[model samples]
Target: MIINKILNVDDYYFDVFMSISESLTGFSVNELQSTGLAEIYYKHILGQIEAATFTEFLNISKNILENSYTQDQLNNAIAAEIFANASTEDIANSIITLWYLGTWEGAYVNDLSYKEGLVWNVMHSHPPGAKQPGYKSWGVKPVNSNI
Candidate 1:
């Protein structure tokens, strides 16, 4: 889609985004995409006209990864980049939060699971206001026995 162009980042950038995002959020790239976190992140950045900020963040991060710097140096620099500008910082947090919770920061928690969001999947529960597990399913103890 056009997002592929708007993001316009190289494979290196995507790889880094996936790596650092995984490291920061503890979610696999598959989870991110399956939960629509990636798309939401793109929409959030594009909505804020912060795509350039994201691109710049990725560029800087990739550069750091390619350097002979210490992990502390890389981590510190990336942290600085994210926090250096409030706008980029917001975007950065939004990306991580989206991956973890499957929703935007300002959005209602229920709205996050409006569809088959990651939270519901990970929690083994249905989305709030979407559907119930059936009237007695909640009390059924789930069949697997592991909770």
Candidate 2:
């Protein structure tokens, strides 16, 4: 990938990547970073997409985030600037899917990706057989405070 070829691991690209992901996924940077999959996902995306396309996408996202003052404004800008383009829309969707499902286009990125998926936390559940909610725990309704 061009990013890996040119930029070091500690480059600002990763910070930009995480910020874009936070906007796309509606998850905080801390939450996404806690998954321990940011670098993996960043490299995976760079490998899948052309360098110019990825760079353009990130640049647009950065601009939108910078120019928008409120969260609603930011979201509107992202919708207009990022998701409005076909290629960028696909990349954005892939990013959201990567966060929620830990899969890129239906294929798991890594073994840990599945176990660390955001969907589990969102649903207040664990990946079956991985975390094991406990024997027969499914029989009881989930105690979701938010609900």
User: For residues 9-110, what per-residue lDDT tens digits would candidate 2 score against the true structure?
Assistant: 665667778887888888888899798898899999889889888898888877776787788998889889888899889989999999899999899999
Instruction: Spell out the clash pairs found in candidate 1.
Output: none
TM-score top scorer: 2
Per-prediction TM-score: 0.55, 0.85
Tens digit of per-residue lDDT, candidate 1, span 35-118: 544544554545654567778877665665565256577567667766677865776677666665656665633454456455
As a whole number from 0 to 100, the lDDT of residue 71 in candidate 2 is 82
- Model 2 clashing residue pairs (backbone): none
Runs off by more than 4 Å, candidate 2: 1-9, 134-141, 144-147
Point out where model 1 deviates above 4 Å: 1-16, 64-87, 108-113, 116-124, 131-136, 140-147
